[model samples]
Target: MQQWQRQKKASPKSQLKVTFLGEAGVDTGALRKEFLTEMLSEIERKLFVCNGDGKGKNPVYCLNSLDQKYFRIAGEIMSVSLAHGGPPPSFLREWCFQYLCSGDADHLQVCTSDVLDMEMSLLIAKVNDATEDSITDLTDEIINCGYTGVVSLEKKDRIVRAIVLHYTMRVLPMLDQLRKGLQLYDLLVLMEKYPDICLPLFVPVHSDDRVNSTFIMENCKTLFSEKGSVRRRQECG
Candidate 1:
C-alpha cells in the first residue's frame, strides 16, 4: 500500500491528456446507460473523473466502463498540451477547455447538464476542469473559491428546458434548505427529504459517504481571512 502511494502521484496523466471515455464490448446496464446519456449531454462537466476503481475518494464510483463513459459523453474531451514542451504549432491547441476537441470559437452551443444541474444553463465545473471557460461546480470549488457573484449566465431557452420537469421535481422541494435559518433547524427540516437532493448527500456508491454536503454554503456572510475559514465575530477589538 505504501509503495503504491509513493508511486501514485495525483498529477495530470503523463500520457496524451488521455481521458478513458467509457470502454465497452457491448455489456453495459440500463442505469449506466441512463447516466451516460445524461453525462454526454451535460454541458458543465469538468475533468474531475471518477474511475471505476471505486475507492473511498469520490462521490460516485464507476462500477463499469459504462458509468465512466456516461460521464465523458456529455462534453467533448480535448488534449490541452500536444507535446511535452508546449501546445501545437497552431495558435489553438488541438483541444481547449469545455472538454471539446474543436477549437472553433463560433460553433453553435449545446445544452448540457449533469444528473444534478439539468435545468439551469448554470454549471459548476470543478476548478481542475477550469480551462479558458470556467465552470462553477457546486462542490467545494463554489464556496471556497473567491467568486461570490453569478457564475453562469445564459438566458433560459429550449436547450435549458429539456429536463425542466424532472429538475423542478428535485429543485422546488430542496430550495427551502437554502433559505436563511439555523443550521440545526435546517438539517432537521431537510432530513425529511432523505435520498433526494435535499438530503445531505446521496451517491450510488458507498465511497460518497465521506463527501460532506453540509459544507456547501449558499452565502458568504462571513468576512474573508488569510488563515482559511473565517471567524464570525459580531465585533472585534
Candidate 2:
C-alpha cells in the first residue's frame, strides 16, 4: 500500500514556479547587467549572420532588403555608441535587436502600431479642453487604458506586450507631467536627465496592479501630498 501511494504521487504532475532573473525582492542589478551582456552578444551574433563578419571585406549579397535594413539600424546604433565611448544603453540595445530577430516583423509592426495609437490618444486628450480635475482624470484614464491594452496583449504576445508596456510606462508619465503644466521642452530635458523612468516595468512577472503601483510610487513625486513631502524632507534632513 505504501509503495502504491508513492507511485501514485510520483505519477501526478506538480506545479513548478519559474522565476525570471529580475523578479521583485531580489538583487537585480548584477543579473540585469548579465542579461544585457548576453542580449548584446546574441544581437552581435545575429548581425554577423545577417550582414557578414565585421571585417572590412564586403559581406556576401545574401540578406534580404528587410534584413539588411535591420542590420544597418543595428550598425548605426553601435556606431553611435562607439562615438559616445561606450556600449549602447540597455534599453536601446534590446529595442533594436527585438525587431532584428528574423520572423518577427509582424510582431514588431504591431507593437509599433500600438505605441503610435497610444501617442495619438495622448495627443487627442491634450488637445481637448478640460478643467484641472478633468485633465488629471483624463490623464489617468488614458494611462490606465493603455496599461490594460498591454496587459491584454501579454496573454498572447509577450514581445509586443513588453515593447508597448515599456513605451507606455515611459511616455505616459511625461504626458502626465505635461498635463500638470510642465513645458514640453522642459519635460524633454527631464526625460533625458532621467532616462530610466520606466526601469521598473522590466521587473519580472508580477500582478498588473503591483507593477503599476510600484512604478508610480517609485517614479512619480506628483502623486505625493505636500505634507508627505514635508515629512520626507524633514526625515531626510
Candidate 3:
C-alpha cells in the first residue's frame, strides 16, 4: 500500500494503469477494476474490526498503524478505487460513515452497540446487565475505564454512555487521517453533498453478502486434466 503513495505526483485526471510486480498482463481496464476490487476487499477485512453482529466495521486503533498513516492510505485507496471504477469501502459503520461525511461526531447517534472493542464491549454489557448485587463489582470495572462519575443502578445509563463516548472519540484522530486521504478526487465533497446517494459506497444495505470461495469458483477458470490420465480419473472421483 505504501507503494501507492508514490503516485502523489501522478496526475489524477489521467488514466490509471495497474501492473503486478512479477505477473505480466496488459490492463486495458479489467485489470485495474480487478486490482481495485481486491484492494478494497482486503482493506475491509484487515484494517478494521467488526462491530455489532459482525456486519459493520470500525477502524482498528493501533499506534503503529496510526504512525504509519495506514488510515490515510486506506482513504486514498478507497477514493482511487471509486474514481477508477472500483468498489467502495462498503463495510464502515453508520456512525463512522456519518463522521466521514460531516467531519464531526456531534450529530452521530451512537450507542453501546457501536463500540467495537471486545473487552470494552463486554465491560459495558456487564454494566448494563448489572443488578443491585452486581453494581458494586461492576463499579471498579467502569472506573478503571476512566469513568470518574459515581456508579450505581440509577447511574448505569450515564456510565454506559460515557464509556461509549470515550471509545468512539478515541478514533477521531485516526478518522482525521482517513479524511485527509479521502480528499482525493473531491470524494469527500460528493459525500457531503449527496450523502444519501453515496451511502452505499461506505455502508452497504446487505453487508452480509461478502466475497467468498463462491466468487473465486465463479470467476476463475477450471483446468481439466488430460483425458484418460490417472489425474483425470482422480478428478472424476
Candidate 4:
C-alpha cells in the first residue's frame, strides 16, 4: 500500500496488472479484476465490522488498524480498483460512506442499533429497554464507559444515543486516514461532486457490481492461434 501511495498520480489512472508468484496465466485484466475483488474482501475482514443488520459495515476501532493505516490502504485500493475497472467496496454503511464523502459526523443519523459490538450493542439494548428492574444494571454498564450522568429510566434513550455517538466518534482518526487514501485519482473529489452516481460503489444497492462469469467473458478478450496451426492444437491440448 505504501508503494502504491508513492507512485505518481497518473499511475493509478491506467490499467492495473497482477502477477501471481507461482501462477502461469497472463494478466489480461482478469487477474487484476480478481485481485481488486479479493482486496476489498480483505479490507472488510481486517478493518471493518458489519452492523447488526448484517449489511451495513462500520470501521472497527482497533489501534493497530489505525497505526498501520489499514483504512488508508483500503481507500487507496478502492480508488485504484475503481479507476482500473475493479469492484467497489459496496459494503460500507450508508452513513459511513456519507461520512467518507463529507467528513462531517455531525450530520449523521446514528443510533444504538448501529453499534455492532456484541457487548456494546447488548448494553445499548439494555439501556434502551431499561425497566424499573433493569435500570440499575444498565446504569452501571453506562458508567463503566466513563459516562457519569444520572441514569434514570426517562434518560435511558439519551444515554444510549450518547454512547453510540461516542463510539462512532472514536474512529475519527481512522476515517481521516482513509480520506487521505481516497484522494488518489481524485476519487474523493468525484465522490463529493457526484454522490448519487458514486453511491452504488460504496453501498450494496447494485448487486450487478459483483463480477461474474458473464462479466468476465464480456470484458476479457480471448486470443487464439490460426485454426490450422500446431499452436492452435497446442492451445486446445
Question: Which one is best on TM-score?
Answer: 3
Q: Tens digit of lDDT per residue, candidate 4, span 114-219?
A: 7777788878877767787778876667887667778888777678877887778887788888898899878798778667667777876746456422343354
- Candidate 2, residue 59: how far the Cα is off, in Å: 5.8
Using TM-score as the measure, name the better of candidate 3 and candidate 4: 3
Candidate number that wins on TM-score, 1 or 4: 4
lDDT of each: 0.28, 0.35, 0.80, 0.77
Name the better of 2 and 4 by TM-score.
4
lDDT of 1 by residue, 54-153 (tens): 3211112223422334222211111112112221111111111211222222341322333233113233223224443444334233433233444443
Superposed Cα deviation of residue 2, candidate 1 (Å): 52
Cα shift from native, residue 207, model 1 (Å): 2.2
Error of 2 at 68 (Å): 7.9
Relative to the true structure, candidate 2 reaches a TM of 0.19
What ranges in model 2 sit over 4 Å off?
1-28, 49-62, 65-69, 72-237
Q: Write down the TM-score of every candidate.
A: 0.16, 0.19, 0.81, 0.79
lDDT of 1 at 57: 15
lDDT of 3 by residue, 77-174 (tens): 88887777676678888889899999877888888888999888988888888898888897777887678887888888889988898888888888
What is the Å distance of residue 217 in model 2 from its true position?
A: 32
Off-target runs (Cα >4 Å) in candidate 1 are 1-166, 178-182, 185-205, 208-237
